[model samples]
Target: MVDSSKTHEPLLVARGITRLFGNAYALSDASIALCRHEICGLLGANGAGKSTLSRIVCGHLPASSGEILFKGAPLTAGSARDALRSGIALVAQETSLAPDMSVLENIFLPSYALPGRLSFSQLRHKARAILSELGHDHALPLDIEVRRLSTAQRQLVEIAKALALNADLVIFDEPTASLSPLEVDRLFDIMGRLKSSGKALAFVSHRLEEVFAITDRVTILREGKTVAEGVPTAGLTQADVIRHMVGRDIGNVYRKAVSPAVTNEQAVALEVTGLHAPPIVRDVSFTVRKGEILGLGGLVGAGRSESAEAIFGLRHRSGGRVLVGGKEIAPNSPIAAIRAGLGMVAEDRRTQNIVPDMTVGENLFLAQMGKHRGFGRGHSARRKQAHELISRLGLPTDRMDANLLHFSGGMQQKVVIARWLLIEPEVLILDEPTKGVDIGTRQTIYELLREVAERGIAVVVISSDFEELLGLCERIVVVSDGYTIADLPTSRLSEESLTLLAAPRSSAERNAAFLRDLVAGHGGTAFWGLIDEDRFVCLAVAESARSAPMGLAAGHVYLAHETAIPLALGRRQPGHVTESDGRSTVLTPLSNRRGHDLGWIGLSLPAGSKLPNAETLSARVAGLFDTPQDEKIDA
Candidate 1:
């Protein structure tokens, strides 16, 4: 993946950058280089020194120790004007365009505000030519007001403005947060044009998919220091990047759910019928079994969130009936739903989820205050419970009294999950439970959900990742444009099938057109793979195994007969089975006597299906069967 277009010297370079805030270091001994025709991604979780570096490079903030060089010339500090004059430009995430001015004026406003003011007509012509060079559609008319433009269109104008300044290095900080997918594609097209035209770019975004999709390389920071650098996009998985950032191998991110213990099977935890919401959802119906994980999947804005809200009494449903544990629940009131043993963790944690100013202890017991003794529990009691949750969820508590705003984004998300976990609801709904959290936190959240479900709680998770739903849910319901398109066991769903079902078009149409072309374009290989409850079908097992599964689980090749098969193991199955001849080649299920498969053993046979040694196989089987089914793996 050598970028041949990059033939110039370093367009910008920073050496030994360091920034300190109070006693804590924000950035230390950091360095970076940018070449014209290359796009570099600055990646890290919140508070990972990315913003600090950006500010330093743009000369908005002075670094305690560091040297910045542009075109081999030493750079000045706190003089943004000097940096701009030197051909540097930065586009912050916050909207900076003038609202009342026309798009053309805003595009050339920086230059127009310079010492020698240019006429409005001359600036408009320059803006138009610059916008055209950046591949922006001129038909939209530059005379349109900035306030009326869409977020994506505004981003285009921002880039056009940069081109007008003839900036050699352009830095974009989370530029596509509010842009739609189609708009993002258009922005990427513009970025490609910039790259081809020999301009350097530095991008900061929370979306790892976008980073890997566009950036030539990435730098990962942790604790104000460069933890990892020079990570190429090629051969990188989301998990790989997460592991580097989080310092752990988060095993089975979507943890296995507690298989329902079939006692008192008549209990109905949640029931919904005739659920209708606008834009995508319409007339949805479903029932969640007690102690089961029900998964919801669909394309973005397919009314999954609406359905969750409607059921939780958060949305005003035109027509819908929500019954919790055999009682008809009312709509449009979250408090009523909570009283009915239902709890929901909304999608956007920043706005709709946690309370930022609250302490960790206060946030943990937010929902359970009414259940405590007296009007409210004493501070000591609440502190005790908060400490317990912190220990159980492995939350960082060195600064427990600190506000949630002080913690990293992942930590804040964990606090949100902990808040719900303390409530002990009968029916819990999680919408994108692990959206911004690191891999380690995601695993913890998964385990926490599984623990809740094991207590006979019905759980529903709405996720954008198809693989997540397939790996965690006992049964998945595919919703498309407000309609229940498919309901099936996790075993019956493959990534291709789920994607096809979740798409806007009918399955037949997708198979005939999109699927045919996708398959052909992909060289007839299913790139996404089948996602089952506990495992996923991987292409080239050897290649996958080489990277090692996250965490301490060691890779192994056990003779299917060598490993022990414990008694009543829940849903965990053995290694993925493949067929060659009539022989039944099996991967030994990694399990304890309690039947919890921790790992797997792979075996293959070329000829007969019969066991190699009937007596030995029988003995092993009998031993496993004799073990008590109630044994639990201490996972």
Candidate 2:
């Protein structure tokens, strides 16, 4: 499906690229080419050399051996500054912005390194123009400090910075990981504009859907080697891409079928009620049963990680009750939480979990040492168990003496997971466990967690990857604006529904107000939800006190037959359908400007109450999606 004429020339070419880290080859003979007027996808699993090639091209790291050509000339960039001077820029996955600097200063920081008189007013004007081109002119301010912005906002700054350089080739690494659907669309629009302007682009990401949507061609890597090069995206399927990335056809990467049975009869391994940590976590509550995997899912900065920290005593709790094994533990005491059989793998493994100075074996026993009361690095007590775990995790015992930093990111993550398993705690919590890990390693981690759950250890996983959450966990607890908004079975949820449920409370205020208006004007109950076959996933609900009860509540899933008004829900017609109980219900489909399905809005009224015209109600629901961003209803 590749366009033969477009493949004739390349703006940049890399051949036989190889990078070494200590005794291992991070990249081996990896080669790729990016043509002008095209966006090439750099596709690979973690540690598969995608970032290695990108870094070498951007001059952040020197290639051990390779030949690179820019504009048909031999190119050697001694440093990042040299690469920028050559019209190349990389927007890294981990941002490189200075936290203390304002947005305007950070965007023009690269310019400061060059020998030229700087003008603050000109730089601000240029930054504004770049942001406006990316469709985020109003979202980011010029004077605000970078440290105060959320992850997504900071990413926008990174993109705008790259544009300010006027680079012909821009490399974006996991650029959309923190963006919402709307933001993603705007980014794509910018990419389209860049492509039409005859600029070459390299998009490095693990999200295959984005690659298929944006890239003209893809180059896949596995085991530090190029598996597929210059493969046309139009001809490839998801299964084919997965096969190339992991070296095998993986069926259902979540491996949910391997999960153990979890029932109400099982004991609650961890219970958090009314948890509060000012400025982040607020009034969060959930329970995980023994042998079950519970997911904490929400947008970035929604306090999912903060809630986990509060329960594990890593954060000071203003109010909350944490119980492990049916016994309440002291608030804000990590030792008490550990004694009560609770373990946590924090969000940032390098800073929070790993001890880089220690050997791998010693790092594996670090948590066990913390729990030991006898002192003197009590590693001998769990030495045998540690060896067994290491063997099961496929880690080489001979390399146990090596520095923990020498291993790959996936191996380091396994070591961290093994650290907690050494304690044999009844409850385990992992935040973003698979972040920066490869797809194959992710599958292995999934299987390992399933095995741990089967051993009766309750597991709680907090992730920004909604698809991973739905695939790995039995149930999901949605947090929005620092509150546990919904808890539902994974079977009843999808990525789209989860996004709607996880919308910030401020962003969702308009829909809430519209529902309230519907109930107050019609004397009925109004709700918003997604319908999948015979099931309904309710996101929000509002009812008038004078209205009859509909036996439905927010944050709950139900079968079509289980509700009092099954007929109306099953039909989902535009007009009102009356049930045997003399209640009339109407369902109207909701969609955004891009025609993405937001789900349906419903209203149920008692028999005697006058029903609003179906067309008028549908128009009102449509208005919610069509409203301008600046004119949205505030909370």
lDDT of 2 at 413: 89
lDDT of 1 by residue, 245-359 (tens): 6666556566564464434464779888888755445878888888888898775546787799788776787787899988988778777787788888887666577787887
- TM-scores of the candidates in the order shown: 0.63, 0.89
- Clash total of candidate 2: 1
**Best candidate, lDDT-wise?**
2
Error of 1 at 370 (Å): 6.4
TM value for model 2: 0.89
Per-residue lDDT, model 2, residue 522, is 80
Off by over 4 Å in 2: 1-8, 99-108, 114-166, 176-197, 257-260, 625-627, 630-635
Candidate 2, residue 61: lDDT: 95
- In Å, residue 596's CA in model 2 sits off its true spot by 2.1
